[model samples]
Target: MTRAMGRLLDDAAEGGRITPDEALLLYTDAPLHALGQAADVVRRRRYPDNIATYIIDRNINYTNVCVTACKFCAFYRAPGHKEGWTHSDEEILRRCGEAVELGATQIMLQGGHSPELGIEWYERIFAAIKASYPQLTLHSLGASEVVHIGRTSNLDHATVIARLHAAGLDSFAGAGAEILVERPRTAIAPLKEKGEVWLDVMATAHGLGVESTATFMMGTGETNAERIEHLRMIRDVQDRTGGFRSFIPWTYQPENNHLKGRTQATSLEYLRMVAVARLFFDNVNHLQGSWLTTGKDIGQLTLHYGADDLGSVMLEENVVSSAGARHRSNRTELIELIRGAGRIPAQRDTLYRHLAVHRDPAEDPVDDRVHSHVSSTALNLVPVAAAG
Candidate 1:
């Protein structure tokens, strides 16, 4: 590394923040390991506890009937397709029960944007789930979904968010934030909400006391500057509201998606993104390694690079898996992965509160149900009516 780059890394390690331009330069020019070392230093200093955390949650995909069909998604079927499916309230409640039985503390209710489904649809389901399983935090949906609901229901963003929050929605997930830069974001998800609009939704949500994580979907032929620009946008918002709890950057899955297998983020590229995000975001507290999309080896390496969390066991996940993500692990394996990385394993809740910290190997708890991979039996299970 050059003297200037080394100084930049050192400055970052010493708790100094770098400007977006400087970050872009380092993100593009800095050597991978050098950047990672500095990022790891920053992480160690910030999280002195040496506890790497993971969450036990289920991504309850309620339906796959989508209108904003992005190029990179292989999961959603367009509206009115013969193969579309929407789980009845009973089915959804059943899955919630399953997740709670397996010790899941969070539920991520993901689905496609159906015009027929307005805010009342979400309100009904979210209220039902909360009534049944008040222990489960509903960290589901994204800004785009908020926008879709607003348009469909003829409500403003704040009103829609207020209604959802009143119902049972706990927080927003950073879905549909592929590449927040206009050029690439429009290229991939042209029909989805704009990049700035995504942040606006978050800002409004944060204003109302609801917080969220900012997710990055890298390696879709975006320029390095655009990648850094995405982080810059999120950071600017973080500076204002301090509402973002974590920043998760994952690669684009290609196998079963519409973009085909043409583009992908290499393991090294993913690690570098993790390190850069750690260095750039001074305000965001957590950085999650995407074991679900990037594989466990790289995910484990992220603990050393700068990530404090290993994301979820995802009692069920269909979005990325539908697109070719093949990694899987149970709760036991996740704990071992953290311990193997020389950090204590702590299971966290939706709000990042530690539920259980495994400080001793002899005391590690094991469960058979906390595994990944949910097939698409319902994707083609036959079209069900949209949620009311």
Candidate 2:
């Protein structure tokens, strides 16, 4: 690393902020350890408790029928495809019941952009889930979904967000933000909303008091400069609204998708992005590493590279799985992974509150039902309420 880059990292490590240009310089040239070291410093400074958090939640893809055929995704089927399916509200509630029985505190309600399903469809689902499981946090949808729902319902993004929030939606999942840069997005998810439109929707959500996490799907042949530019865009929005709860960066899966086995980010590149994001997104508080997209080992290493949270013990994940992600973890093993990484293990709510902390492994709650794909409506024919 150059002397100037070392100085920048040092300043950032010591809680001093760096500009996006400076962040790019460090991201491109600084030694990997140096970048990680600075990010760890920032993480320690931000969270002094030395806790690494994870959430127990299920990704309930309400339907696979979509009109926006993103090339990088393998999960969606065309609206009229013979295989397309949408779950009934009763089935969705039953799935939520299974999740809650298995100790889930959050429900990620995501699906495709079906032209027939508008804001009312979502409102009905959200209302049902909230009515049945009032304790479960509804961290659902993303900016792209909002845009689709708005267009279909002849309403604006703000109106969509307002109705969803009033109907018990808690926050957005920040999905469909493949990359905030325009070129790659057009090249891949051409039918999706533009990068600016996605950000604008999130800003509107923040204005309406609905916070959301921001995410990036890297390694789809995006330039490193573009990666930094993505961070810059999120940072700028965060500076004004502070609505982004966390910044999650994951690699694009290639198998079973239109992108094919084209290109993807390496583990080192993922770590570097994690560190750079921690340094660049000073306004954003949490940095979550994707063990679901990457492997569990890489997820463990991210705690040292500035990730404060190791995403979810995803009870059911179909999007990335449809692409190529095969890694899975249960509650016990996830806690062990976090503890083995030298950080205390904690189960967090959607808002990052410590719902349960496993400070001592001996006292770790034994929930056999919390295994990977343990309780779901996606994988088995087991009755939803009787599955667990």
Candidate 3:
């Protein structure tokens, strides 16, 4: 690391705030541990209690039929493919019921941009879910989905979000933001919402008091400068509205996708981005490590670096799994992983509120059924009692 970069890292670590250029330089030049150490300092300052949070949520991909067939996604099918499917309201409600039974506080209702589905489709589903599980947070969709739904329904994105929020949608999942830069986004997911449009929709949501998270899917042949630019764009918007609750940067899964494992971000690269995000997104409150896409070990290591959240104890996750993310964990193992990393584990709601904290291992809640990769929709066919 250069002397100048070292000083920049120190400044960022000490809460002095580094510019985007400084962050890019630190990401490229600083030693891994040093960068992580600086980020850890910032994290400890932000979350003084040394607690890492995880959410118990089920990602309900309501449909696989999509109009915006992004090249990087293996989860979405064509609009009329035989494999295409959309979950009925009854099916979705059942999944939500199962998730609630297993202690889930959030439901991430994601799907493709089917031309057949309009704003009314989402509004109906959101209303039904809200009426059924009033306590469960309906945190689903992203800017891209909003654009598709609005265009399909001939409504504006703002109206789409407002009606959904009125019907029960709490916030967005920050999915579909493969990269905020234009060139890479055009290359990989040209059919999806543009980078600026994504930010604009999120900004409008924030204006309406609906907070959402921001995300980055790295390793798609983007320049280091572009990565920093992505952060800069999010930071600029956040400076104006303060809507983004957290920033999650995850690696791109190359398997089973059009990218075909041609290019990918290394584990070291992932951690470097994590540290850099911690340094750059100073205004964003929480930084989550994607253990589901990356390995569990790297996820734990992120806690040491700068991440205060380990993402979800995903009661059910299928999109990344469809694209070849195999790592899975339940509540029991997740608590152990957090404790093993020398931090207290707490179950958080969609709003980042501490729903339950496992400070004492002896007092940890025992629910083996809270395991990941277990289908939230299949709990009925295989009873939890019998399955456990």
Clashes found in each candidate (C-alpha, N, C closer than 3 A): 0, 0, 0
Model 2 Cα shift for residue 349 (angstroms): 0.5
Clash number for model 3? 0
Candidate 2 residue pairs in backbone clash: none
lDDT of 3 by residue, 131-215 (tens): 8999999889988888998899999988988998999999988887889899999998877778999999999999998999999
Q: Any residue pairs clashing in model 3, and if so which?
A: none
Off by over 4 Å in 1: 374-388
Q: What is the lDDT of every predicted structure here?
A: 0.88, 0.88, 0.87
* lDDT, candidate 2, 90-168, per-residue tens: 8899999999988899999999899889999999999999999999999999999999999999998889999999999
Task: Tell me the TM-score of each prediction against the true structure.
Answer: 0.96, 0.96, 0.96
lDDT of 1 by residue, 1-388 (tens): 7898889889988889899898888778898889899999999998999999999888989988899988888778888788778889999999999889888899999898986799899999999999999999999998999999999999999999999999999999988788899999988888988899999999999999999999999988898889999999999999999999999999998765567757778899889889999999989999999898888989999998999999998888887777777678888999999999999999999888999999999999976766874433423323232221
| Candidate 3 stretches greater than 4 Å from native | 376-388
Model 1 reaches what TM-score against the true structure? 0.96
